[model samples]
Target: MSQVRPGARRVLGATAVESPVIQPRLRTIPEATVARLAVYLRVLAGFADGGRTTVSSGELASAAGVNPAGLRKDLSHLGSCGVRGVGYDVRALRERIARVLGAEQSRACVLVGLGNLGTALADYAGFGSRGFRFTGLFDAAPDRVGQRIGGLPVQPMTELEATVTGTGVSIGVIATPAEVAQQICDRLTAAGVRSILNFAPMTLTAPAGVDVRQVDLSVELQVLAFLGQQRAVPAGEVPA
Candidate 1:
């Protein structure tokens, strides 16, 4: 079969064609490892665009900001054995990682909160352009509710439970204020949401089996400040 270049096809290692769903035989690979596979896939695609046909484990690690040994170990779980001296086939590895990450299949997402950030996220072209489709947007404010943002209807928060339950929304983007984030999270969890991409600046407690990933603007700014301060310090000024 002729494979379409730049399409959603996966190439595992040198010759294996794999699907995104984890098979019973490959259940040993951790979910964290699976997440990183997508990161690696994006890096490899960059290399492929640069005319590189092959990449070593060390090279892939450097590009993806991971250790070579760890990268190799993760790839090994996918049955990707790097050639002893030839390294890995870049195209093959890229496809395999995409397959494992389900890049070919789009996942639906719901966004809650119609604040500035939420509005921007609702309008974000990256999500839909990628494999994440946003089918619902919600907010608690009556004035904002029933409005349309980013081509998605901003429904009232009262409908969150039903919309999520009916849509089988596995992923949620929480853009609500810190005060209401946990409450929203609880509702989402109770409504069967399993994964959350949290932009609220508060710690949310969820029961087992729920995955919550936080994106804190202040935290990122602080890290950037730390890096800037480190650069300003003298190399040998440790006399404190």
Candidate 2:
């Protein structure tokens, strides 16, 4: 008698048996859809907190600041279809969206640089409530080091690698000056951080598999100024 392994065809005398081949398809969700899902989840949470059990597409769309059809289309990605004359179950929808967004798991985050912007982010109370826990804060300045901000003592940048490894931080925030932003990013990536939130004026580049999001307040303000100037200009007037 010949022994048969799982998924391998077994031969007995003149007969052979084969296992069925199963191929799984990977589902790819659009980045824009994922962002809108977060907004929808928040709106759903508010509804649930208000003792609402169900929400119509139009109502949810209005609350989420999107069109009803577009909201329905987004929800379709989750394979959720509302019943006739009834809307989605608020609590269920919220839980589904949260699961898809990985909001159920808390991620450790480390902050580098203790400048004004960094300090403001450290003091923000929304991080904890939104599944982000600050595990470490670092600064290059000797004076800033050893000082406490937002209940966490600021460590020297020299301790960044150790702190990140010890805390299992997956996300790093760079608030350093433009000159040192890339250096800090490299350090963070080398320390095993794959996601970064950058507030520095200069753009920071990361190696493959690392995600970096930059928030430039100056650029945002300049965009607003440009729009203001456009509005100020008359239909036929050309500014020299």
Candidate 3:
């Protein structure tokens, strides 16, 4: 019998050397840290586009509109750090964030309503890159019942439960009008959707155990108006 090398294998049933096994490290980063990671990634993308190789924490924070200390803490959670004098590697950090966020994998999502914003979101390509797959489209409109948006066929509101059950869709995106926002949310909850990203301009009242994230355009505009008013006022002026 021939002796195999320490790191080599022999043919057939001959002796084979074992290779070093690498232990997988377990990491549990905070949810807040994970959220900031995306902002850092976008900042890194801008740097990459400008041919930048390194970015200081301060620079990244400024670019991403975050605090320097907060950005440093978030990056540190991933076991990544900038050298004493040098900054972080823009490309490497972006790839690391993408991996941690599971951006490469495809996640299925269901969209309710076929209004303008809903149609636009269905047509948006950014969701695909971020592991979001728009698999089902539902609407109350009779005409939109049989329509197709972004290659996904639209189904009537009545079929919402069946489609969600069949496809195992958990993430729901509600884009219905303000009047029917709560009603639609209840139906989505009934269909076993746990998480919802609502675009309707109203607060949704769902049962316990259901997560509803509201994205009200009108409320956003109000916030913008408040900020604009602050800017319009003098630096030392007080608002009534």
lDDT of each: 0.80, 0.81, 0.78
Clashing pairs in 2: none
Q: Please report the candidate that would top TM-score against the real structure.
A: 2
Off by over 4 Å in 2: 1-26, 234-240
lDDT of 2 by residue, 1-240 (tens): 011111123221212233335413224556667768888877887898899999999999999888999989888876755776898988788878887778878989999988998999999987876678899999999999989999999998889999999989999999989999999999999989999988888777799988777777777677778778888874746658
Say which candidate scores most in lDDT.
Answer: 2
State residue 11's C-alpha deviation in candidate 3, in Å: 56
- Please report, as a residue range, the 10-residue window in candidate 2 with the lowest summed lDDT: 1-10
**lDDT-best of 2 and 3:** 2
lDDT of 1 by residue, 1-240 (tens): 011111233332323344557543444566556667877877887899899988898898998888899888889887855688899988887777777666767887899998999999988886774578887899888999878887778898888888888887889999999999999999999999999888898888899988787777777667678778789894856578
> Compared to the true structure, candidate 3 yields what TM-score?
0.75
Count the clashes in each prediction: 1, 0, 0
What's the lDDT for candidate 2? 0.81
For candidate 2, the C-alpha RMSD (Å) to the true structure equals: 12.7
* RMSD after CA superposition, every candidate: 9.0, 12.7, 14.6
TM-score of each: 0.73, 0.83, 0.75
